[model samples]
Each structure stands twice: as structure tokens, then as C-alpha cells.
Target: MANILLVDPDDNAFLALKGFLACGGHRSTSVSNARDAMVFLRENILVDLIFIELKLPDSTGLDFLRTLREDYFFQHVPVVFYASKTTHAEIHEAYGLGVQSFHRKPYLQESIEDEVAKLEGKAWYWSFFEPDDAFCRRTGRSLDERGAALDELEPVIQSAAQAYKNVNIELAEAEKEKILSEISGFRRKVREVAVPGLEEYLSYLASFAKESDWNEFKEFAALMGYYAFLCSYRADIYKLERKAKQASAVLDRLAQNALLRSLPPHEVHALIPHLRDYEIDEGATLFKQGDVGDAMYLIDEGRLGIYVAMEDDSEPKKIGEIGDGDIVGEMALIKNAPRSATIIALKDTRMMRMEKDAFTRATIQSPQMKLAVQALAAQRSMDSIKKRAGEIDISAWSKTASEGVRKMGERIPNGFLRKDEKESEDIKREAESMDHWNKMIDSQTFPVVSDAKLKRDIAALKGCPVVGSAVAAFTLATEGMVTSLHPLMDLAEHDPGLAFQMLQNANALRQAKTKDLESFIDDARLCVNFLGEKRLSVVTKGFPRCCESFMYLNEGANWASHIKFLLATANIARFTCAEMELLNIERAAFLGALLHDIGKLLFLRVQPAGCIPVYLHAQEHNISIRESEILHMGISSRQMAIQFVENKSIPTSCKNVIRWVEEPEKATEDFDLVSVVAIARYMCRLCKVGFSGETTQQDLLPLEHSQLWNSIKDRVLQRFNVGNFEILVRRRLRKF
Candidate 1:
């Protein structure tokens, strides 16, 4: 067994490599950072090989190698730099520092074995000892005999290659038939697996086979056969993952949903694959009243408002609100009729929809499920009739008649009269308040500065050189320049203020615990890994001068709070976008969230006194900063942001995102992205990650159950393997 030292900052990666080495009869000692590796090397002198990651917590692997090479005892030790991706310059530099080999981090057992074999060949002590003849004979051969055997094998290898080519010529037609038959079998499996778009792919491959020449046909057949096998393998993996995910979702639904709870666990598990998951935005219609219901939906999250429209053309009366675990439209499926009420999402909602056919099958298979469905359907039918009867107009009755009816209604104690009266009074108060607030907003004047003036003011302020350099560095990293660390170090050297802010952010977002980073390079590496290239680039570009501007506008504590808020918002936005699968606009979302309050920064820079009055008004009224801005000044912080990026190269869609995040209802396009940013901002405030000078703790534009923790609870459970989001929040808040 070989004695090896493994140095990598990633705990998972280090453990995985260590396990692989153990399986190969090799012993490994691991340290997560350069400082620990140095201590280990000094204490233990019997290591035969060393494997290091390119990026370390305290120093680059290359730097460590240079230091190690200076030590006489370790100069000739075999060192391998195992990394994800390395540039030519980094490779050359590592070589110059006396690295014996550079290996790409392997993801397969065969690749791991190959790396171990290479390490065994380069053991420094092996050369010092002479081989024993008896041992050599037992192992198969001496050096001379091994060389002769290799010489003998070369012709045999060539002969085999020639024979392989001839076999294809001899059995071309038969081989084609065999491949076609196998492909035909695979097509049925593909369909059974239900891989989206695989049918069309197989059809295209079939066409290619028919149009090719003999030699090309053989090649195409081989390619098709391999692809089919690969798809089948992937399908198996996907099936396992899907089954695991659906099992949890199903168990949660069954535990809470009354109708589903009646069914057996095995029956629910069987039904899970047929259920379709959907995410609906607030104010979006699920189905209209009197529409044919093709599916029944179970609410897994958020609230759905059930409304009944009057025949007299009056506003629709909201019958009730149904929340998580409430099943809707089941009656429609059973009766084979229209839906009784319109269901609309009152907030962003998640649901699992089971079609009529699947529901029928489930009911048919489980008599208990059928009985439960019938009982619930009958109960809903009775409730629907009562709700419709209550909606009848009673204004035509005389006062005396109404009083007599009210006395009679009290005797029965239906409870509708008292509830309606309470609701009416609440609605009246809300309407009056809105009217007064609207008048105040209308009376205010929103000053619009010319673009030229805004540009001049922005130029006059000292920019954060570190942030600018990070942006430049991110750009270069994307273009395949030196590691992301190079640009970060350059930026740190240029401006320590920006570097300090970045380091703070890096420490906040780190998922692992290592020694505190001692330099900008180490911090940069951590940031790059945490935020990734795309998000880091977006963040740096969005707030080019945030640190400098914060210092210029606010005092010590306030400036620090503002910086924390920006970084927290940026990280939260990234997490939200990834969880939602919004890949196309992830960068845009990250940038929009980070710079959503840029206009406030600009106001602090150019019109510091103007914001004070607005701040005071917001505090007095218990409103958000945006509302106060609109109430005191006709425009909002969003308007300032619009002007700030008006002349810049930002996408119009991204600009719309920033404009409507505070008021998502007003957004004409990209509403989902805007809502995501809005939710992320709310989360940052809810967690009290930092102070953004917004007075109100509650969201200004509210939706029921729209808080970030509520909306993303299931997602966090699935993605982060955590039961509580507070744990994630506390982990992120460590730097604070």
C-alpha cells in the first residue's frame, strides 16, 4: 500500500478521493488547506505521494509546491495537482515549481485506478532498491523479459486490428440486421421510459441508417446502438431519482390531504408517477366556473381563491379560500360535469394535478378511495347550493321586512350575516385608506433628472476599483485567462476597500469551514466557487461602485449594513433562481436583485437631503421605502434605477425586472422573474440580513403565504437536504 497525502479544501471531494485510494489498497491523509498540509508534511515524513487541489484556502497549490521544493527532504517527492480545469499558464507554472504530474480530477473508477498506477510508477524510493530475481520471476518478468514480451505483442495487436476490419466486411449485412433488431427492441423501452424527445431522436437515427453507404451504415449502426444503450442507462437513473422525489411529495400530500389519506400507501405510490406538478403565479386562473374539469388538483402550497360570478353581471363573490392539502375539482371528475367554482391562485402556488383518467384508475383499484371521493363530493354539492342561495339580492326587501328576516336569520344562526357585515366594514376602511394614500401620491412631485446630469454625478463619485477589477477578472476568467484569483489579487492591490467587501461576501456564502483566508487570492477562490463564474460576473457588473458609494453616502455602521444587504440579496437571488430552474435569466435575476436599489444609492449621492424626508414619512406611515418615495416624490426608487441603467447596455427585460419587483402587479412582461426578485428581497429583509433603510418589516405589496420561507420550503428540502431554511440563513450569516 502507498502512503499518500491529499490536500483539498472541498470536504466532499477530499473524502471521495480518500475512499477511492482506500479501495485501491492505498492509505491517504487529507488536509483541507495549505496551513494544515504544511503541518502534516512536517510531522509525517513517510508519505510516498502527494495530491493537491489547484485552489487552496490559504494559498494556491502552485505556491505551496514552490515552498515545498525549497525543502531538501521533499524536493523529489512525487506531487500531482488534481483540479477541475487548468489553464496552460497554470500547468507551466506548476511544472516550473517541480510538480511531478498534473491530473484532471477523475469521476470514474477506471480513471482513478489509472492515476494510482501512475503514482505507483513515480514512487521516489522505488529507484533506490534493486529488484530481486526471485521476486521478479514471481511478478511475471524482469525488465529485459518484459521488453521482449512487449515487442512480441505489437504484431499480434496489428493482426487483431486487421482481423477486426475484415470481420465487418464479411458480415456487413448480417451485422446490420442484428443492430436494427436490437434498435427496434430499444425503441419500445424508450417509449416505456417516456424520455421526452427520444422518439424523434430515434426516428432521425433510423433515417440516417437508410441513407448511408455500407461503411457509413456500419458506423451509424454502431453509434445508434451505443446511444440507445446510453439512453437506457440514463433512463434507469432518472427513474430512480424520480421515484425517490415523488415518494416524498406523495407522502407529504397523503399525510395532510383528507381524501388521499384514506388510500393505502402502495396505492398512492402507484399513482404518483401519473401526477403532474405545477407552479402557478398569483392572480393566475386555474380553471373557470362552468368549465369542463379534465383534472383534479391538490394544493401543496399557497392559497387558492374560489369565486362564483353572478348572473346579474356583479363582481364575483369569493366563496372561500383553500390552502395546502385541500383538494379541488374532484366533484367535477366524479359527476362528469362543469366545475362549480373558479379557482385562482391568491399567491404563488405549487400543486400536484392528477388527470381524470388517473383518478378513475386509482378509485377503481382502491374501493376506500372511491368511497372517500363520493362522500367529499356529496358534501361539496350541499355546500355549493347553500353558497349560491346566500348570494341572492335582498336589497329589494323593505326595512321592516328585512328586520323580520334578520330576526328569523338569527334564530337559525347561519353566521353569514355577521361575517358579511364584518367583511364589509373591513373593506370600507381599506378602500378609504387606499383613496387617501392615492391622493397623497398623486399630489407629490417626482423630480426627473436628465440623463446627462445623472451621468455627470455618477462620474464625479469615486468608483470602487476593487469591484471594477473583480468584474474585469470575472470577464477574463470566462475568456479562459489565468485563474479567477489573479484578477481578484490585482483588484485587491488596486483598492483594498472593494476587496474587503468581496472578502466579507465570500466568507458569508461559503458552505465549508476552513481556516480564515489570509489574502485576497484565497478569498477570491472561495467566492468564485461559491458564486460561480456567471453569478459573480453579474454581481460585479451590477454594482460597480456600491462599496465606494456606500462609504460616500452613509456613516460607519450604516455603510456596513448597506454592503451586507447588497451581498445578501445577490446570494439569495442566485439561490432562488437555481431552485426555480430559471437558467435563462439567472444572471439577469442576480444582477437585478443586487442593483434593485441602485437608485437609492444615487439619491444618497446626489440628493441626500431629499431622501431624509421620504425616510421620515415611511417610518411615520409604516410603509416601505419604495412607497414612501412614491408618496413623497411621484416616482419610486425603481424610477431612479431606470434612469441609472437607461444609457447602459442592460437588457430591456432585465430593466423591466428591476422596475416591477417592488410592484409585481404592474409588470407587463417577465412577471415571474420580477416576482422571484421581489420574493428574494423580502427574504433578505425578513432575515434582517442587512439594513437597506426601509422602515417597514412587512412586505409593502403582499400576497398570502408569499414569504420566501413558505414558498421555497419544499424546494429547500429537496435541493439542500435541510429541514429548516433558518439553518441555511444562520450558516450564511456566520460572517456577520
Candidate 2:
């Protein structure tokens, strides 16, 4: 109903107004003169509508409307003129002053009712308030021609839901990539068609309120909210996929840790997201003995000392220390018991902690992690059982050694690997490893080692611990009629246990091996020189390294591949060494080149179908493999190699090369060696001699002309300019 102010003084006019007002429930306030009407209009300037008679006793319609338009709310009010015997000029002037319409004297009540009903909704006032008439016409035209906006958005929204499903399924790598393309198409469709089409419709509907059909607009907008929800759904799907991929990468990295290796790959997959980051300052007790254990922690960095209670509680005797890659408190978490021992951070330690509840929930479905903990706890009972050489026969010790190791299940996060994927080691000899530390923690009698025990422990060890494929290395070793033992020896450098076995088999050591053995296998090449021909032959005859993928080169025929690419990298490294004229690093550089990509092999195993999330991210963003691995996994192949070999007996210079081969400036110890391997690999990648998962084609950074050239360029000889080096590399590549 309309709010009208009538200015006619005539009583007959009041009865005539009933034709529209009485039937339609329209409200009106009438005045006998312009004086009263003007007073009412001034007080209620924001009135919805106004009606006036030109034959009013005090004033004309023109004078009233002129004042309303000039001094009042300025043309914002709709006005109608109703008068008897009004002149044409007076009507023309009122119409020119923006009166909505003119009603003739004694007009039919029904005819007036039809005109008033036209103003039943705010569409009458909308014309005065919302002046975008052209846009309103356009919005209405689009609605009639294109049908509803939902017709366009509905199909796209449904396709987005389907695309999200395709994203989560375990598809082939190529198929997964195809899903990504479809997702990209969905996003483009929304941006280009769906969103643009809905823009005018939504905005056109938004400007309306108090209209009779307002409920219809509100309902339509509510339906369009699904399109809005589709927008959020698409966005959240991207975030979840990214997070899952990141968790998958974390799964792969966590699988490589030493303590968690007891858990199967699938269990680690389920557990990665639940792991909590925790830090303890140096000397702080991680957890006190007898405290209620709610969590277990895996050390990512630094060390912790195990303090067990003794008779009479003698200051919590410190028995042993565990460092990075080791886990603590599994026994407490598993048994649901109080912590048996106190753990204090020996240094500022960073660990991944998992609450019991979170652990249970994360691993409830994938129970391999739980089973590993149980198996180790059950097996740990054996740790307390002391079997001295004086107490047991030689054959018994051999048998115990054979029982501990799970040969084929070494590297982390290969959930797809089956139970039978392990080595063909004699079932009798390839048993579990008898950890001396576990026994020390159990029996508290730290004894000297035995030869049989040593062979047992080394036999249980993986070929390459952090990132090698002993299987691939073994494949390399037995590729031909001649049993090439080079991989085993090279593998021994990364794996000191492997080196110890090779050396032990040679029987050339001066002293008997001890249980407290620290690795000094810094140099891999020295293994052959140190062992004479007969001893070397003995080591060669026995190559039982079924662990990491040591990238050893035959250097004869296949040498062009396994080490040949590195030979090119080495030539560049040697040139860098000669430029500095520091000849010592040439050896380290050469060795580093051969060993640099063990991280790539490790990554390849982690996701044989390509870490699809990592792959798509790299493919889309144009990031290097190491960078992508670091983005999602928090570690790179370069860092993995560093972690694998940091404690090896290798020279510090070689470790430096490995540490900064891709990132030379980050090196703290030996910048020259870093630069050598850095520029060497950069040049080698440019040569395209072979494929390196670590270095992509996009990785041809600006290093050729970068300041790194100063480290390797010969200032005196002028032998290593970028232009000349390019020509040299291309020539070598062409000839080879």
C-alpha cells in the first residue's frame, strides 16, 4: 500500500479517493489548503508518494513540486496530480517538473484503482532511486534470452565435483596429469563463462528490496549460493590436494629415518600428517621416567640421552644416547605404561612428536606402523637376553644373526611394495639385525663384538640406507658374465657396515673388530688399494649388499652411463680444481659426481609413478626436483645424500661437494669443492648426457655466467670462460 499526502480541500475529492484507497488499503492524509499540505510535506519529506489537486485554495501544483524538487529530498519522491478543471499549461508544467502522471477530474474509481495498483510495489520508487535504467533493461533481456544463470552454473559445478573425485583416485601418472588438465579447464570455465554470466543477474537482483517479488529474488540468490559454494569447493580441493601431496612427500622422507624403518611404507603414509613438530633446548629432559607417556618422538635433529633408573635410584644412570633418525618412547606408547626411562636433550633437538590419540587415529586404518611397534617391542625382549660366546655355540650366534634383518624392506614409503620384494639372501643368513644398543639398553652389559655377530649385523643392513637401491646396484653388479664388484665397494663407502663386511671378508685387518666400532670409511677408492689382489678377490666373490642403490660405474663399457656422465661432470670439476690449482679436490669432485644422484634413485623408489603432486607442482611451477622435493618432503636429494654420507668415512671436501653441488653458496666448509661440483653438474645437465631426476631441463640456471665462475675460472690461464666451456661441452657431447 502507498503512503499518500493529498492536498485537495474539497470533500467530494475525499470520497472520490476511496475508489483506490478504500479497496486497496492505501493510506492518505488530506489537508484543506496548500499551507497544511506544505507543512505535512516538510515534516514527512521521505514519504513514499504524494497526491495533490491543482485547484487547491492556497497554491498551484507547479509551485508545490518546484519547492519539493529544489528544497526537499530532490526528485526522490514520486508525485501524482489529481485535480478538477486544471489548465493544459498547468498540467504541462507539472509534468515537466517530474510528476509521475496526471489524473483527470472525476476519474473512474476502477481506472484510478488500476493506476494505483501499478504502484503496489517499490518498482515505482525504483525508477526514482536506481537510475541505471539501461543496465536494468539489459539484465531483463539477458534473463529472457539466456534463461536462468543456474542453467550455466549447474553443469560446471557438477563437473567440478567429478573433477575433484578424479583428483583423489589412485590413477596412472599420465591419467592423474589428465585430471589436472580437466581441473584447469573447470577453473577457466568458471572465470570465463559461469562467473561472468552470473555477474549482472546477481547484481540486478541485489538492488531490489520491499518489492512484491522480493522473496523470489532471495530464493534465486540462495540457489546461486551453490555456485558460490562451488567456487569455494574448487579452491578447497586445490588446497587439500596440495596438502595431501605434501603429506605424501613427508611420508617418503619419514620412511627413510632409521628408527621408523621398522614401520611399513603404508603405515608411514598414514602417519605423516599426524606428526607434530617439537623442540627441546639443550640439557632439557624430554620426558621423565615414571611419567605418564602420551607420545613418542622421532628426532629430526640433535640428540637425546637415555637415563634409566638404577638400584636405589642412583641419579638416573645415563646408559646411551640416540640422535637424528632415531625414535624414542615407543615402548611407553605401546604398553600404555609410564615411561621406563628419562630422556634429556643432549643438544637443542627438533623432533616429530605424535600423541597417542593422534597416533591411534592416524594408524587405525593402516596398522603396519602399529604392528612394527609391536613387533619391535616383542623382538626387543631378546635384547635383554645375553648370549655370550662363552654361553653359546658359534653356530647359535650365526643363527641369531640370520633371524633379525628384513632384507628387502629397507627404504621408506614404498607402500606399493609387496611382502616378497626383499632379497634372495639365504633365509638362514638374512635374518634380522641384533642391535647391540638395544641389548645394551636391555642387559646393561656392553660387551665387545664377535666376527660372526659383525657379519650378522652388516648382512642385515640395507645396501644404501637413506637413498640407494641395493637392488638396482646389484642389477648393475651382475649385469654381465663377469661379476662386477665395483658397486658393492662403492656402496660400502656410503654404508660403513657394507664397507666393514667387504674389508672383513678380505681378512686384511690388523686388529679384531669390536662391538664399539666407529666408521672411518671416508674414502671409497682406498678400499681397493688397501686390500691386495687376493683380498680384493675375496671381497668380490661375496657381494651380499641388498640395500641402497649405490650408483657405481663399471668405467669400461657401461661406464659411459653409470659414471660416464659424472666423468664429464668430473672433467669440469677437475678443470675447476686446476683453475684454483688446488689438485686435491679433483679426486673429491670426481667421487662426488658419481655419488651425487643417489638421492634421485631414492626418490624414484618412493613414488615410481612419479610423486604426482610433486610432479604436477614442478611441471606447473617450473621448479627443480630438489626444490620440489624440499617443498613437499622438506628434504631434497642433495640433502638426502648429505644425510646419508655425512657420517661416512669420506673426506670433508667430498661431503662439501655433495652438500652444495646444486647450491654452492650455502656451503660452510669448503666453498671451492662446492663450486666445482656445482658448476660441474650445471654444465653436465646442459650436456644432456643422461637423465638426472635431481636436475630438470629448466635447471639450467644462470650459473654459467654467475660469479661462481670465479671459483673455477682460471684467471692466470684464461682457460674456463663460459663461451669456451660451452663449445668444449657441446664438442664433447657431439663426439661421444
Candidate 3:
């Protein structure tokens, strides 16, 4: 195994590289920046390989490479540039400086394998799946040892509990004082050590879900049980103190929301007394995964990080952050489930928590509040879940938990883990006994997702039969909350139905001389105000349910995936445009990207069923979907979309992008716009955000190797954070 040194400030890159090394039978130590890398190198003289990013906070990767070359000990050490920010000149300079390889961002398993195998002295031969593999077997034994240690700790915890009981029941003064001392020591142990350790385990297990084998999954479930046992015994540390002084401020903020504004002043005021102010210190965890949802906190001041341990357990991803006037932990209240994500205070924070009982009572008193609360809960759940929904291997976790865990449970003291046993047990048992594996997985995970407030909410959507695309549906379902003009305008250009409806409504209002007509029809942000949520709702809902052409109507996974792809492209387009701003492509790239795949739905709607799985073939053959479209039906999807919008009120720049997106150099008037779209599409493939038919690789070439990236990367690197943009594109993939 190679002793690798990782130099990258980005957590995304660091985790990715660490996982790569761990899986490939290599040892690695990581430092965030160049100085740390150098410092580590000096201390650890036996570093075998180095994976460095080009743009470091303190110094560039090229400078680090030069620094390495300057030293006799470090010179000739195999170095790979694991980054996206590279121009031809940078690459040429890197290789000229004796760099061994350049592995691009968003790497595939094969690429990872290839790079690992290329490590000069590393042992790369290992079976990843087999249970008997050296690493797996070794890790399994270590886990057994860890489990035994937990077993040893159980009796001590039991002794502490008994001591508390003994002191409380009645005891001599000396004995009582001794028991009290034991209780205090136990409190420190559980609060300072047990709680934090258990949390770290849970977070890591959550991220390790996909890679874990049956035994490891069982271990995770057992850990969950231990966590509950610890938390229950240490309840005194978690007891909340309510502050009545912040009631006025809490009431005022609560009144500002749309739901509160609709209620009568008395109804709104009645709910104020139930809110309890909570002060969370900087770095304090307000709540954790698997915690009971007794209350939901509405932020009053300071930032809170929403962390989901999705793909990597070493670091739970900070998916988003919320400040004053935002909600957290509501989904757990709505679904009546344990917390799915952990909320940690980034700074000293003040929040008003509304207990579930009071919230339920308030909603019961006001029917409008119930509907509004459910709607908000559904939106929030869907937003967080959408980012990490399909990725978690819950079925695997369930299957492992159900196997002889009955014996394990019988051994544990009855109250070991209080939650999840009754609710999730049947789902796990049912999953383990299913005949069909795929069906078992879907059903098992359904329970996990059902706790996302979707069981009730998705059922409710059956009543809302709207006629707009997913893009439009997302816009309105999210409360028609438009923060910027471009996201709105970009979304409008993609949904043909939305665009046409807006134009028709604009014309009707214009001819009638109504005040509703905005000066510009293309101003989507202003135009949306006139469109009305009710009207937009009708349009968007109808697209998936009303039309036969809308793909994956009843399939939530497929539906989410398809919509996610377009949104992913839009993200890439934003980056592409931002990068291309030097050459003066404004919002054209974003608008063009929205319309780039406009014909995909048309293909599904108009084409024969036999040939509609163009993406499947496109992926299989490693060819462009457009090429597959042309090969299958003698016409491209983009070409069909171009015809659809030719007579509509579509922007010329967008139309040109549709025309030249696949072949940007062919465009004359809209060269930069077309180029940006082309570049963005290329990125969408590279990042693998959503599964489209497009082959992300340009015929065995990476992004830096792609002709388009090489042509424009010089300018792109100056303005764009390629690593961050890749992160954003993948994040958007999970989001949509």
C-alpha cells in the first residue's frame, strides 16, 4: 500500500481522495493547504505519493510542485493533480515540472482504479466486494473488538443508574454522598464522552451506509441502540430551560410568515405563549440524528448548519445554513419520526421552540394552520430529502439489522435503545424476508422516506392535477419564492407550456389595457407575480399527470432523476456563464441551458414507445443522446424543440443555443452563448449530476483534455472556481 499525502483545502476533494485511498488498499494523511503539506512532508519522510489540488489558499499547486522539485528528498516523488482548475498552459507547466498524472474532478471508479494501479510502489490488487478481502476481514475483527468494549461499558452504565436509584430511595448520609459523587462522574462520562462518541459513530455510519456489509450495518443499528441508552440515562444534561422574555420578538417573527398573516389577530396571538426561547452556544448541537422531535425551532438570531451524513461519515455534509426567521426540525414533528439530519449552531444562537403538542393544538384550533403547516413540512422534507434521497442504502441497513438482532436485543437491558425498535422493526423484518431483492429495497426504504412527510403530502398532490413541467412544479411548490430574475427567467425558457401561458396571459392583459401587464413579457421575475400561484399550480401539476408525454409520471425516482438532470445543467450553465463573462456571455448561457434539452419531453411524447429509451442506449454506447435520437428517428430532440419554440415568444439567443449547443463553433451571431451552453453540457456529463444519455467523456478525454475546455479554460480559470462549481453541480443534482 502506498503512503499517500493529500493536499486540498476543499472538504469535497479531501473526502473523495481519502475514500479512494482507503478502498484501494493505500494509507494516506491529508493536509488542507500547501504549507501543511510541506510541513507534513518534512516530518514524514516516507511519503510515497502526493495528490494535490492546483489552487490552494496560501499557495498554488504549481508552486508546491516547484517546492517539492527544489528538495532532493521530495524530488521525483510521483504527484497527481486531482483538480478541475487546469488550462493547457497549467497542464503543460505541471508535466514540464515532472508531475506524473492529472486526474480530473468527478472521477469514475475505473479512473480511480487506473490512477491507484499507476502508483509505482503501491499494492493495488484487491477484491472490493468479497467478504474475505484482507481489509474487510481486518476491519470486521476490529469492529468485533469495539463491540466487546461497548459490552464492557454496559455494566458500568447500569451501576451508575442503580447508584442514582439507591441515593434517591433512601440511604445513610455517607452512602448518599458517595452515590451522588458516582452520579456526577457518570454525568460527565455520558455527557462529555458517551454522547459525542455516539454522535460521531452515527454520523459516520450514516455516510458509510452504502459501502457497509451486512455485519457492519448490524453494528450501526446496535450503535443506534447504545446511543439511545446513553441519551436516556443522561437526560439531565439535555433538559431545556424556557425563556419567557423573548416572547414578544418570537411573536413578531411568527406573525411575519404568510400562514400567520391569514389568521385572525386573536388566533395568531393565541399561539405565542407556547413558544419557548432556547439559547444554543457556538458549536453546540441543538439536536442530532435519531433524536426525538418533541419540538421544532424557529431561528431568531445566528446561523445553524444543517448537516446530513450522506455519502461520507468522516464529515457530515453541511448541505445548507439558515439564519433568523427560518425553521428547523419541523419534518420530524410533521412525520412523527426521529430527526433525519443534525442541526448544529455555527455561532451563539437564539431560537423559539414550539413543542409538538402545542403546534398540533394550534393547528387543530385553526384548520388553515394545519393545511399551511403540512404544506410547509412537505416542502422542507422534500427539499432536504431530494438532496440525499436515493443515495442512502437503508435496505442494506435494514436487512443487516433484522438478522439475529433478536438475540442481540434480548441480551441488551430492555431500555438500551428506546426509539426506532417498534416503528422501523417491521419494515426491516419485511425487507429481510422479501422474495424479490429490488422490491424489498424499494419497500424497506419507503418507510425511511415515509418519515419524510411524503406519505401524506404525495397523496395530497393526487388532488392537484396541474399542467406544467417539473421545473414549473418546483417553482410553485416552493411557494413561488423567486429570489432572483435569472433562476425564474431560466426556468421559464425551459418549460414550453409555462413560457406559452405567460405570453398568452401577457397579450390578453395588454390588449385589454389591464394593470396586470408588465412592460416586458420576458421579465420572468415580474411576470411570475402576475401568473398567480393558483394558476401556475394548475399548469405544473397537469404536466406530469395530464400529459402522456411527461416521462416517469408515477415513478418518483425516475421523475426526480429526470428533473434533477435539467436543474444540474442549469447549474453548470451558471458556472459556464460566470466563467465565460470575460468574453461577454451574460445570462445567455443559463437561458440556453434551460432550453437545451427542451425536445427530450417532445421525444417521449411524440416518439414510439419502442424507441423512447434513448438514454439507455445513449449511455450503453457512450454516444451523445442527440446522435442516438438522430440514429433512432432521423431527427434530433433539440431539432424538434427548436421547431416547437419557432413560432412562440422564445428568446433568439436561447433558440440559437438549441441550434448550436451540440456544435457551438458552427454558430456565428450567438457564438459565445452557444459556446457557453456547449461547455456547460460538457460539464453536466463530466459531473454525472443526473443520468442523461450524454456521454460525459468526450471520446476518452477529460474536461481539461476536452477541446472546448482546453480552448476556453485559460479565461475560465481566471474567474471560475472549477472545484466549487463541480460541487455545486452535484449538489443541485441531489436538490432537484
Top candidate when judged by lDDT against the true structure: 1
Better of 1 and 3 by TM-score: 3
- Badly placed stretches (over 4 Å) of model 2 are 1-525, 532-564, 575-580, 604-613, 699-704, 707-722
lDDT by residue (461-501, candidate 3, tens digit) is: 31212222333234433343433334334445544334544
- Minimal lDDT window, size 10, model 2: 551-560
Candidate 1 segments exceeding 4 Å error: 1-485, 488-557, 609-613, 620-623, 630-634, 699-704, 707-736
In candidate 3 the C-alpha lDDT for residue 621 amounts to 57
RMSD of each: 27.7, 34.7, 29.4
Error of 2 at 279 (Å): 70
Candidate 3: lDDT over CA atoms? 0.53
Please give the distance, in angstroms, between residue 600's alpha carbon in candidate 3 and its true position after superposition: 1.4
lDDT winner between 1 and 3, please give it: 1
Q: Report how far residue 37 has shifted in candidate 1, in Å.
A: 36
Q: Please report the candidate that would top TM-score against the real structure.
A: 3
Give the alpha carbon lDDT tens digit for every residue of 60-127 in model 1.
Answer: 89988987887533466778887778899999999888786787643333455576687655555333
Q: Comparing 1 and 2 by TM-score, which wins? A: 2
lDDT of 2 by residue, 427-482 (tens): 22223222432343256342223334433433343333322222233223333333
